[model samples]
Target: METNMTLYHGSNIDFEKISLDKAKDKRDFGRGFYTTTIREQAKEWAEILNYRSRRDGCFLYEFTFEKTDNLHIKSFNGITEEWLNFIVENRLKGGVQHSFDVVIGPVANDRTVNTIGLYLSGDYFLDEALRRLEYFKLNDQVSLHTEKALSYLKFIRKYTWTA
Candidate 1:
């Protein structure tokens, strides 16, 4: 990993100056600075945020994280039983938190949400869920889970949302 890697976060709020103190609970990765390496995914997220939460245009904020040597990071290769279980635990716990500074993995976006529900709700087996989820190539999810992780971030720029 590079010492400085660019990460993009798309949101309805202005992150020019951010405060994670107000981050909501029960998030997919549990109230962290969620970002993606893929720009188009962020673009889609910006539109979604604009449509669902804000009247104003969605803002795309760029940040650089010193990923190589600065923090304790956990990387999940792809969607698997281990990844699914961890995500489910964090989401269901809602208030429960993790000690990891950062977590990098596939984002359980809208497409996977239903499938995740089925697996979690006992509607599908692990193999069955993996078979279904494999149809869609998952996008990356980068979660800055702790304040220490935030300290390593440098805000880059803000972009206007375009549908």
Candidate 2:
């Protein structure tokens, strides 16, 4: 099942860059068009995550271990819930949706296990959403990818004005 969450931002922006002149051209049929806006956003998010990772120095990794160790004991757990709430509250506003699946497994040493998951979310503005999600994998560093997707969704949310 696909889960949807909306991130609310307070303004509108032009996210669709395809020109009618170009779109109407018969030769353009089946030809793929590209947009760099989301790419830029993803880059921004990646940088943020990278910086945090560098500073935390395996904090994310350790958190994963802790969560796995106490999986059965549920009650306002560790960074997982904190991360989820952070993403949901801050990143996921203005009609932007984020969906992700949790994964747990063993790391280098057989004695210890690692727990991590991919957070999948994107905007409705472009066709690249599903492509991006499909390309992502567990343990893959995709802060930028997710960020760009979210940015695009924010772009879409802005134009879908109801007021």
Query: What value does the lDDT take at residue 21 in candidate 1?
Result: 73
Scanning candidate 2 in windows of ten residues, the lowest lDDT window is: 57-66
- Model 1, position 28: C-alpha lDDT score: 72
Error of 1 at 24 (Å): 2.6
Candidate 1 C-alpha lDDT tens digits along 35-69: 89888888788889788875677888888878865
What is the clash count for each candidate, in the order shown? 0, 10
Backbone-clash count (model 2): 10
Instruction: TM-score each candidate.
Output: 0.91, 0.18
Best by TM-score: 1
Q: Give the CA lDDT, 0 to 100, for residue 67 in model 2.
A: 22
Tens digits of per-residue lDDT, candidate 2, 1-163, equal 2223222211122234323233211110111111222333333333454465453211111001112222221122222333333333423242212232122111111111111112333333123422332333322111111222323222232222111
lDDT of every model, 2 decimals:
0.81, 0.24
lDDT computed for candidate 1: 0.81
